[model samples]
Target chain A: MPAERRARPADAAKVQRWLDVVAALLRRSPDRLTFVELAEQVPAYGRGLRSRGDERWQESAVARMWERDKDELRALGVPIGVYPDAGGNRSRYGLETHEFYLPFVHSLDGTPARRTGGPPGVSMVAFSPEELAMIRRAAGRAAQLGDPAVADAARRAMASVAHDLAAFDPDADHGETVVGQPLDPTVLRTVGDALVKGRRIRCRYRSMHRDVTASRTLEPLGLVFQLGHWYVVARDPGDERLKTFRASRMSAVESLAPNGAVAPPRGFALAAHAASREAWELGDGEAVTVRLSVAVHIALGDLPGAAPASAAVGPRARTRAATMQVRRLEPFLRWLLAFGGEVRPTAPRHVVQAFRDLAARTAATYGAGS
Target chain B: MSAVARFARLLRLLPKVADGTPRRIGDVAKALRVPAALVREDLQSLAERVEDTSGGFIEGVQVLLDRDHVTVRSRWFRRPLGLSADERAAVALGLAMLAQEGPAESVPAIQRAREKLGRLGPGDAAVRAGRIGPAAPRTAVAGAQRETRYLAALQQAWVARREVELAYRKPGARAAEPRVVRPWRLVSARGAWFLIAEDAARRAARVFRLDRIDGVRLRSATYEVPAGFAVEDVLRDGRVFMGAGAGTLEVRYGPAIARWIAEREPHERQPDGSIVVQYPLADDAWAVRHVLRYGPDAEVLAPARIRELVLAVLRRMV
Candidate 1:
């Protein structure tokens, strides 16, 4: 077995400094401390100042270090507040006591005596046992999503919950099991991180219809896991149009920024884009409404964006008539063809002709001419 | 892990062990979902003293680490940290997915949990951005709802160790058949649910697709799962279908859909730009439907019986 890579001494000391800084801030909560005061509280910030030849560089480095520490803590949901002084140079930072800590979670059935003023820096939230169990099951299910980004986030969320609960046994079984879909963990993680951080990504995407791989830059807005696949709903900066790219088809996904340098367009609703769309409606072609004779048992509403059409009599009397808008004809044809004789496209002359041609071509492939 | 990540973990870890109670390192590691050695390293770092501005050492937290167990005495960070934005979003998405795919009865509880987590409320940016919540709209797909209903009932039966008689309609069958089985486990694979159970009549384990089950009637008789039986034992090949005599199926995809097919599962690329895959074939009717779904994009390459079945379906369709 390969040896474990231990943490360097310098890294350990840096972590210790961070711990000390957080301790100082929490100890003096609700009281703002300037950078000078914080430096006093965390001695490591001023250490080796005299030994360095570049005093000015060392001072700026210390300032940058302080800024980094604050950003890191805020990222961990520490709720560190900053108040700039009148001079606009000296900023006082402090921890928001109420927001820093998790609320006291209790079972709804328990009716403990309420203190007129509970302990300082503490609040409460109540949930039933079944509710808590559901949350636990949800976390477990999320961990099995086959997406590393989601799994890590789920683990962190559950850890926080476990910390607040007394006598929390992590080994307790939740009676839920999942066989997650096989997905590219790297692509999922990269795309997910970019979406969460609101960053742009450059990737090589293999387009299925065109059967060509092309490099493109995208501003990732949201992630959707549907139909046993993960998709990134993003916008091409060049066109400023929303497109959904299957996560598995993306390769070499590289984030363009260190932080969230870009934000989604104003008033853009991701739900509208993330809604379960049929294969045919996902294309960029001109809209074509194709009338179909669908089996009565198949609900039109369930077909996603389908509307009832005027029924025809005679041979098609038993089947209901429906019309659905199609952006890509091939996928629409394939979808209708999949239902075999149960569904038939009877619409504008071209659509019916195209359907026949496809069927004939398919039959020809099996040595049966149309 | 990077030092910053380690720092964040240490912040969370301090609250876990700072209650002045002795906790086994292994137990703490398991609870934190981290390696035991990493836990030990964090504890060691916490035990070290830091120099204050006045040339004096300040002991933030006192740690008592021994061979197997460790305890900490600290007045700092005794409370757990609140969930970060990303973490909250993740939890919200989990609840949302469960709301969509879990048992129907759990919806209310799932909703309550979401409300408590400050999600799903009006004007929530995360919800607006579609970062967290159900990916699909809540339009009830009859087939999906039916599967969830059967899944809920089967789950209860499995937990109670009760035998269930399923009105299961096999593929291509016109009528449902009654099958008595002892429920063992409910597993989801490839976006579908299946029941890994023991067939009482055959006295052997079988896998049943939840959608194909017309109805589930709980039987009064209870049965114990065999000691040596494991879900993996039946699903060793990673294929959910467990027909009596399964064979390997070879199919080739046309160039047009080859890239799409390659994205889904493993396949070998042919020089002609097509792709060939060996799939597990258990039911002839399933193979026919699978090929029919792809239309002419897919062709049965080997296994003449399966090829014949595909041709037969194509002939009927044409």
Candidate 2:
């Protein structure tokens, strides 16, 4: 509603000032302009310079305003370069056209019209129709994820791309992709901001396996969405070990001050942390490799992290032996049970026995009909 | 509005109006999803000129604004800004989620888009490699590929407005039943895919889990999605099983797992630290599997019929 309100006249003047500054910088690009020269050229900053009272104070105030404006422009993806002035202590700024503007997009079949250094003063990027369609669908899917911050970003990205390609429409109907699991949008926004800023966060986390709630301070490394849950991979300051906390289980998430911020270690790869692991491997139980006799019809490639144990015992074997590591027995048993009789544990007598016990108990429970 | 936000919006706006063609202010606002008053304000701002210290004027964008129409005569900012880091991450993660869950046919397109976006620069490359933004799991569970295959076929039928003969197996059923249905839409919730269609025999909408669907045969007979038919009418609040004459069932969770269950949905905590939740039960078989998944951690507290069904299912499993 606030955004819908009519902007005051002063707002328009401020926007005009900002636009004038950018246009001036672009026109005089390749030749940096000092703060003094820019202040003289832009009317808003020039007003302070023209004041007869307290020249030093006025200049400092103007400098602070410039700093804020420069930061805001940079946040908008405008690449403004700052360089030390050769003649004085003042700083000179410039905005390169290529860095400030999007590249000219060309279809794959089109030839390179001009080089980067040509008079057009813009570089070209090529995209096939297939690539654009995928990008469109990706943006559409993200818009349906039910997170406001993520949906906003997705919409803006699609709008920008659609502007260049006449054939692409951002508002086209793409089938929905929804996450059934509920997510706390506020928690996700806080964690995302902290991760991007390289800051620490403190939150009350409820550990599902241990069923305990405690406050923790962690340096967020990355965010991963797996198995219908969003997990924040962070390093606990106390243990100095990485841990993953489900976002839905987090409450009162707050970003720490800049003083508590810490950068991730060098050579840390988030993809490694985000790699998919089986449900059984996510627990804290001791790891053990269990061999299973999988039906021949079931494809081995469908199972991640599973390897063939040995050759089949003759060609007539209806099942093949395969082995996979397990960290927790319960989840593994539950997963295997979902396949009914198609999969069976064949090794580690205790695991096989445990599986039979669970199956038996489940059956007994059902047999005791109300 | 903040000066930066307004400036960014003006940049988006300039590309649309700068072609020197007259456009309705309401039309522009609708396209941009902004208020018409805000668009008018931005147009006025773009047409304003600022005075320099030299007593001269620096012209803003040239524009012609009227009560209902506006046109601009400047070539400045004709192209929209490149995708920002956050935007790139959002898009990359989205593509990753789709690749992990969408139809197999989309994999090649998703991969090609990622490669092209990565070629843009180091920032884009980092996003593509999952160094920035949320990353989706690279691998999926077994039989997910088959589900996606079915998803592709169902999507085609839905788009073509054709009926499909589906071999769908109910929970605990020994064989899949063949049924002809008019495909409406394919929805992916949690990690599973589902097709919301109208069963021809019953002439009623039904939600069929894609994993339970053994085969799909497209039919030459076509049908229209009923007027005002909405996916929400079937999947209320992202839930799959919403049947007519559904009854409320209560289930209790032990204290150890109560907090986890509470995190998932609303529930009432009992004095003993256990929590009780009322769920809408549309199918008795679905309720049986749902309770069994929790093992002893959960128990049926009400609806004796469901309790009996759970016991019967467990006995059958044994």
Candidate 3:
């Protein structure tokens, strides 16, 4: 399968549960399924199975209901194939691609930067009139350059600041303690240059976890603002590896000239390497092939080459009769690992063995191994 | 294929009068890289496309040639094809947006350019309509709210000139931390709001995330906003938190990897278009990991340090 599959996740529990039922249906029915029939069999979290006679359902409702059904199927690692029927009959819907594809949707599992709460030891400070004017101008300029409606909204909010400046009494005991002071201008400018020029920057960094100090050269690439603090997307030249560093963690910065090399692309774009984690990165390196037997729990019966979408799989049916070829192994492994033993890693013995060994090792460590 | 194509061919060739100018049929043909016979056959057809109206349109279409050179001189008039209404609205909106970003002084130049386009009516009506500026909607009410926030912080900072306490959260970090910092100038980097301040405890400049700031309060102390505090310096300080880290990496290439790299331009291109290129990286692990993704197609070449790291990682995985 394409590595792009890893980009979409059963990122949320709602979707993850949906995938489980879909996978079960695919395992049982490998052929094409009518939308209604598939949705009937797919389980719902809080509701008991509905009778096929339930007249409350509409085609649009069926369509909407399948989103969760499909999401859950993907989470369980079942591929649901869809195709246009060649017979031209109105009732026939064929399965097209052999493998299942989950549409590209933004996962709800936001990164750590998105979590709420201010930086430690700090209290909220409202913007002043002059500062609001600057913010409005700044946000407007930013929107004009690239960002869309959100930037415009920011500008609108900035412009709303009332001019009557009220003095904030520091000792008035607002019942909140300030965490850190405003950053000096000199440092922000220096860091901005390093990022723009993609040059090596030398800086005095203080580790947050421990009392340690060190000077290091960083190849700056990108910057991200999340959860109310500045963070640099830099690679440590010493290690030549990428890592996110907090702005507050640094003690000082020493600027350096560009090394004449063009900087790598970064920012918020999906294509940017920063957006993907290391596991996804691994699958991109080399493509590996794996073979798997469809479990009875999957609804592969609806697949064109397979059986019907509603084929029943009784527990005693027993034989491991189906198999498939998968190209990328890392993401598959990660996804399969999350399934525990429900979906077995069948082949490329190395991969299967690796999974087995890992499980064994963990079990032994926990004194639960046979 | 047609008289039109032949005429276009001749007009395009007029620029290459490389040596001394030649005005004869042969010179024009030679300049155009075409046979003289072909040039002669197309001259009439080409003349028709070069309009000089009032009947003078066709008259000016005639080309004058002398032993020294060939010159195209004419008082030609052609009907204008204007822009549609939607296009005009789009242009007006775009211009208004552009005006917002640039210095106020540039607005006049924009107006003048619009006037010139209008006078040159040879273009579409939409193009002409674009000359008139689109009025921007008012946002004074919301602007007041934003001002209240900015001023409140500014006044607090001004009073303390000493470090104002800030709460900041760096993205991707497991959690946010507390830091004491002296407030400096607040600016926007790209689109995000940022506060440039000095770390009072560390005695170094740093940037704070305005949104992540849960709290802010001024202390009873005073310190200058530091005359030498350059915005760029603080940005660099903030950058360290951005890049993964810098390290050297060695990539080895097999024939397939070499060909793939060559075709895709995956790495930076050298003037020679060689298969391999190297540089200092902020995120060495990321680079090495990325290179490894190419699988058997590429290899990691020395400095042996990176190779050892990759090997060590793979060994642990295996």
Candidate 4:
């Protein structure tokens, strides 16, 4: 076993300072920074605490600190380059300006930093205030629900737009608020990068259903947020078979290919994959419509797959029967169970049986007596 | 962050360029939380890496410094990374569910995402996207035009952690009943939105259907919820009716109903394939009304008060 890291408050604050120092250095351009020059300008880099002649002490302490900071920054994706100093040794460090930025596109809107390019019609049209807000919100929502890095990326994408982070409608997610489970931002960003680049990713994935973790190379396809969880559908590069993996369950994520590693089929749409699904499918099962005895005005209006087929007036408004088309019986049953006594299945005996069994088991949890 | 993580972030910020327009070095520095010098080095290293390494992925990728702005000259440098159509769709779908009850201000964002997905990639054909579930927020859809005010008012109170005066129509009630509640959490189930709150008058936790909530007004009074106030306790069996019976409530279902009920629900199954369900009834009256949906297939057998209530209701039906 390895030793546990002794976490300290300064550890985090130090990272921010390290980032700031790097930013300041990049502005200097092809100018190489020696230890003395760096420490003088960026106090965060920590200089030789003593005098200039103390080479041994400075090399052991300050140089070591600088070395570790460079590796840490690199681990975080900072590209620090080393050029030869006056002594012709690779001692000075600097950044190459172009590699760190996106392909610069000057937008008519005048947001100089905004990155934009796609098919012609895509970029030619200008977005209305509302449209931009929606796109930004969608990106914002992804950050809110997925990971911190995801949020940071979204913030960067919308750098041109001036929107407050504490905007309304974000806090109150009027729909399915499954705020219980949290996702690892690192995992989200890794797969996100893979998907964008059309690259394969080697993932240390923990399959909750199978209760196993294994390393597998996957061709990143697309991500879908469903039923309070985010799921990524990836094709097994080896088999060409696609599988949906829960985002939260991914233990480790690493991109295995570069952008454009795999050019997806000429025209592949993720919505098509998502659109054909029955809300109740639950991965396995044949689609079947079941007749349900649901109350009138129950408002089964727009649940995923259980749409209202027909309605029957009952003795009481509460007992009105409604037939619902259930593509996936399991999710449909779970959905019905929420209604409890207000809904029951009368026909398509199997669906009815499933609904009753679920209800009975739920009722039995309280124990027999009352 | 590990190297893989950092590299992934770097990729998102690096878009492929066709034109020679310069991007702000500060933008990359600020976005990645690294210094501009570090970004410059990273870019230089990356460009050199492709030039040095054999068979690099991107073609003719070169980073150039132009005054304060930096741009890449690459044959294939596109947006460093783009969210696939599916990702955008997933986000759009989730937002659509919330849109029902979400503020009108968020609609544009929802619509914008939808349009973006449409143009994301060419689908083989226009395939209908599959949905895992839908959030049919009651007030958002039932009377969408009229309920915006109610939705915003209730959401305001919920966010502020204040008391709310809601005119809620109890099940089967003709008109809404006025009550003050300490809002806790909002829940969605079976295409409907519900608020699990502490009903001041009842002095207990209760789940009120959002649609039945006629009008809601935020109160200035703020209240602290008791410790460990998870909704699972009240949502047990997913029943919203408040409990009234003290002892257990047993319901015996006929074979047809038993077989269906016992399939997954935990219950005491009989030798004849019949099943018995025992539940801690929230309200005896509400329970009676609930069991009535099973019609003649189910009967409440225990807790004399509940049995009496069921019998009285049955007699009235006849």
Off by over 4 Å in 3: A1-370, B1-302
lDDT (tens digit, per residue) of candidate 2 on B92-187: 877786676666777887888887665432243333533233332221111133355576567667757889999888766746899999977777
Taking the candidates in order, what DockQ does each have?
A: 0.34, 0.31, 0.01, 0.08
Tell me which of candidates 1 and 3 scores higher on DockQ: 1
**TM-score of each model's B chain?**
0.77, 0.83, 0.31, 0.60
- Per-residue CA lDDT of candidate 3, range A178-294, in tens? 122234445544665565345677888765445467887777665443222345667766554567666656657867876764354444331143332324335334545454445
Record all residue pairs in model 2 with backbone atoms less than 3 Å apart, i.e. clashing.
A366-B311
- Each prediction's fraction of true contacts recovered: 0.40, 0.36, 0.00, 0.08
Clashes of each: 0, 1, 157, 44
> Per-residue CA lDDT of candidate 1, range B1-318, in tens?
467777878877887778789999999998777889889887876666444446553545679999899998767667666666666666777677667666667788888898786521212432343322322111111112225557767866875789999998787764589999998777776667788888999998888888778789999999987878667755633457666557878888998788777865689999999999888777777776677677788888778887776666556555
User: What is candidate 4's lDDT per residue for A1-370, written digit by digit as tens?
Assistant: 1123222335423533454345555546557777666665444443343344334544556677777777665434345666677779977777544433322323234443343442222232244444544554455545455455444544544442221121322222322233424567777677766665567888787664455689887776776555445677777765655677777667678887464465444455554554435456545456566666656645454333345555445455654445555556655665554453456677887766666565554344323321
In the range A130-194, model 1's lDDT, one tens digit per residue, is: 77766776677667667776777778777766654664443454444566556668887777666
Quick one: RMSD of model 4? Answer: 14.4
Each candidate's iRMS in angstroms? 6.5, 5.6, 28.9, 13.2
Tens digits of per-residue lDDT, candidate 2, A270-317, equal: 767677777788867788999998866555664556799877556677
Q: For candidate 2, what's the TM-score of chain A, rounded to 2 decimals?
A: 0.87
lDDT value, candidate 3, whole model: 0.40
